[model samples]
Target chain A: MKRIAKLSTLSVLVLIMVFVAACGKSGNNNNNASPSPKASEAAAAPAAESAAASESSQPADKKVVLGFAQVGAESGWRSANTKSIQESAATAGFDLKFSDAQQKQENQIKAIRSYIQQKVDVIAFSPVVESGWDTVLKEAKEAGIPVILTDRAVDSEDTSLYKTFIGSDFVEEGRKAGQWLVDQYKDASGEVNIVELQGTTGSAPANDRKSGFLDVITSNPNLKIIASQTGDFTRAKGKEVMQAFLQANKKIDVLYAHNDDMALGAIQAIEAAGLKPGVDIKIISVDGVHDGIQAASEGKINFIVECNPLLGPQLMTAVNDVLAGKDIPLRIVTEEGTFTSEQALAALPNRQY
Target chain B: MNRMFRHHLFWPLAILAALLLFNLFYSPDFFNIVMRNGHMYGSLIDILNFGAPLVLVAIGMTLVIATKGIDLSVGSIVAIAGALACLTISRGTDQNALSLVLSAVGLTVGLSFFLGAWNGFLVATTGIQPIIATLILMVAGRGIAQLITSGQIITVTSDTYNYIGNGALAALPFSIFIVAAIYLIVSLLTRKTALGLFIESVGCNPQASRLIGIRSRLIIITVYMFCGLCAGIAGLILSSNVASADGNNAGLWYELDAILAVVIGGTSLNGGRFYLTGTVIGALIIQTLTTTIYMIGVPPEITLVVKAFVVLTVCLIQSEVFRKKVVQRWKTRRYPAEREVSRHV
Candidate 1:
């Protein structure tokens, strides 16, 4: 009993000491940066005033803060997407607040409630999954804060709940990938055994991409997805799932990945089997990330459909326009296209996001 | 101290030394250290920074395994805690410092505790295996984190929050300091009390511990809770470092790495003994291996195969069958007098 007490006491003391040290260090940092916060805010005020003036004659003091609830960084593309939005917010002069839902609906709901409490100008989120967002969107609507959907769409039927949605058409992207394959493999004789590495199960990208691809593939009888499983949109899992696919299926001619990470992972699996990735087993994937572009250029991956992650400038324009009470479209689709081997190689040097 | 030198750690240390010497001759700039801002900067520093989270998780896993339990939900817990913290602070409101910090901490700790309790309850009360219970959370937690972030990466610009993972204390990374602090605290807690003995007792014989009124259920549950808490802190560190919350990828496959670290540290998954220091060393080994592979310019794709080989080699070396064969070979190779002495010893 004495030993236990002594140990507990020691732990408490150590915790307290560490906490004190942290506090002291943080206090010093705070003191150093305390003046900069005010200075930046003051500098931001003039630009904010002009932005308000350009938008409306509404009082410049009527600041409209926006709270954007985001999905967690699920991929490199997502990280890029996040950076774009954050940079755009700072440049566009919107008092933007960002929350990472870390891919949970509950955290998003909590974020929405907090946003409502703060009485922000607008709320936006890219849903982690499709369902379970109606109640929260309705709540945000009740609070009179317009919501916007980005990248991935929600399942809510009520169009009035959100101001506008600004994202790529995931289903279309998948259809394009499928259509490309269909065009290329039209004359193939034997079963065109294809293995699919899916994105996260129950996610908007996963569901929409699958439905769109399958819808296109169903029109052609030659291309058959012998093995389809979730890679969870990760490189490691993609490799593992592809390995299992190789083990289960004897002849896999085509590899279709929902995203580049999975495709890259599948490429690794293909290489490990001493098979030529581009020639022996053609690779088709979405998300034209830098690594993916490099792979496509290098002839390791055959085709890639681009998902533009640089939605920041467009998102800011929408936010500003919405704040100005201008009539906006229900959906604003970002213009993106697929990249071939030649195009991927040519564009790799110029690719930013 | 002499007896400690005779332990199994001695062999691993010798092996590590030999590997370092081999790398020194084979690799360029293997021991090169660049000093900048009065701090060490190089591949070594990067390795430590990247490996810090794994180290933290492995240490926690060591304790849990010591009680004959496993935590597969740590990765998900990391995502959940990070999501919760980022969500709490990103409301775009007039957030009071105290309230914001408290709410973030409370939400993270509360959720983790709840998950831990669930794992504990299933294992202790319902007679479900620890692996099975944690596996359920492991599968579902990422989904839950995704639900929280609304399928988007939540990016923040809070300097206070960013400091947790990205800041430097004097010359070292904040994460390193945080990991070290945790190790010190956990070491004191286990080594300074009867908790370590109780854990070993429960692991060796649950019925025996129960007979002795050790409250085996409580101990099991507590260790799991502690693991969950450690995961929470790890999540915070990772998300804060990146300045974004990514539910799908944050701490992804971390549970596997944690398990690997624990196993490499010579801790049996079947439980019995625990070694915090061994777990730390194991983390360093994994990190160093990765660094060496990258430095040697091995294609990133082959890393998994290399890791698997290393794990296999270590496990085979520790196997009784292999050990017995090695002993026999050594005895035969040595002189008769030395062989007799070694046998007597």
Candidate 2:
């Protein structure tokens, strides 16, 4: 019994030591830590402004603190979108309380409620999904806080719940992709056996893209979707499903991916099957990501429809306009266009967002 | 008869039957099968193909759980294995069938084994909780995999590697065959030998097992190692099928699915008895449910809510109150001869 007790004590000590070691290792290898020159500049600017404001004759009224609950960095585009919002908030002189929901709706709702309790002047969020926001939005409205939808729209029937939505027209983006495909494959005699790699099944992009593409493509009887599968907006699953499609179907002419990741995955699968992706199987994808543009330039992808993720400047302008009692459109669509191989190459270097 | 009824396999069979019955009226063509390209094509086939990875994970999970331990790191291990295989093959190595396959398999298994040992060392030697110990790897494994692949999807054009994931034998997926072979090996190693008994003994009463001269710590470590090996195999299969290694997304959320499969298989999360066959059925149920949702054209967003509901219902039925109610109903509906058998038991 004594030996057992001693052994247990030793084990407990070892466990503590091991945990410390693990934590120490993680601390040394912090991946999220990056040198932020912009952050430092912004911090210094705030101090300078406060000093200048104190010296001024007129004292500033109550400060407006706005809380922005961002959907976590779900994709590269999402990360850029969040950065835009953060930078814009800092520049606009609002105390921005940002919380990343990490792609979970419950976390977003919680953050919104916390912001409401804090009595933030305004609330903004890029919801992780469309549904389950009506109740929260209603609560925000009751709390006398105006909410702005960014990048993506919510599915609330109550339009008065949100002040305004600032983002790209996702359906139009799909229509553009469809129209481009129609133009490219107009001369093909045989059936245009297309395989569509969809985004997240229930999200706005997947639903709208599917509807919009179908609306345009259904007119052409030859353009049939031989296989349509959800790649879940992920590259890995896209490749897997594409492989399954190749194994199951012999004739696949065109690949229409919901996003660049899926398109890239499909490209990998196409190359693995010993077929040229852009030549043998024409590829058209959305989201003008750097890699996607590079692929298009390299003749691996045929066409790309840009879904602009940088909405900071426009969003901030809309917010200021609304606050200044200026009329704003219910939906402010970002300016976006399609790009072919030549265009992709021309814009590859200058592409910022 | 009482013993048979109390067996873990019996619960999964009952749950599967109940789900099928529920789906029969609600879902059209639930049992419909079609032949295409000399292979079966239908919702059922799709379910089997999709559930293959989950089945593999659950089988590994069963052994781990039987040892009173859990491996939350299987998902990451899968990513690492895929990354290793893809990186290795993309290096323009000789396409000689035997060497290529062996090296890929060896590297994946070896790395996984090392990771598993890390988990084992933490849990067994240091006395850390299995969940917490494995969680470390779970959080960092994908990042490690990404580092291995340099955050790039390594695409390979190897027929030998592709055959593991995409190939078929006798009109069935090669993955299904692999799962079957793994099940056989695991069953033999555990059930047919003293390993299973030892694991159960250790799980049921750790102190007693130690008193009886069983090396409980060694057993725990070995179980984790086996789970790692299984995950490595799963990773190979996943990468091979896609013919690419995507470290960022490979086997993402697989751990959750595997744990869900294990729980649905009637294996108590608290640990004790294990049922390999039940795990297979549980995996099938999950895949079939997913396919059914897709076939019914339910919007993808509501699938999570639906899955949660199904899991809730299954858990409710598995509860003691529900079991008692079921038994009472069964007793009332039975014939006199059946009643006599029940009374005798």
Q: Best-fitting candidate, measured by TM-score?
A: 2
Locate the minimum summed-lDDT window of 10 residues in model 1 chain A: A31-40
lDDT of 2 by residue, A251-319 (tens): 889999999878887786676556799998999898887777988999888989999876765666665
User: Candidate 1, after superposition: displacement of residue B128 in Å?
Assistant: 24
lDDT of each: 0.77, 0.77
User: What DockQ, between 0 and 1, does each candidate earn?
Assistant: 0.08, 0.16
lDDT tens digits by residue: candidate 1, B144-241: 78667655556566767766776668777789998999999988888899888898888888889999899998988888888888888888887766
DockQ, candidate no. 1: 0.08
Best by DockQ: 2
Cα distance off (Å), candidate 1, residue A41: 22
lDDT of 2 by residue, B93-167 (tens): 665366877788898889989888888878887778999999999978876776676445676778888778767
Candidate 2 Cα deviation (angstroms), residue A242: 3.5
Weakest lDDT window of 10 consecutive positions for candidate 1 chain B = B293-302
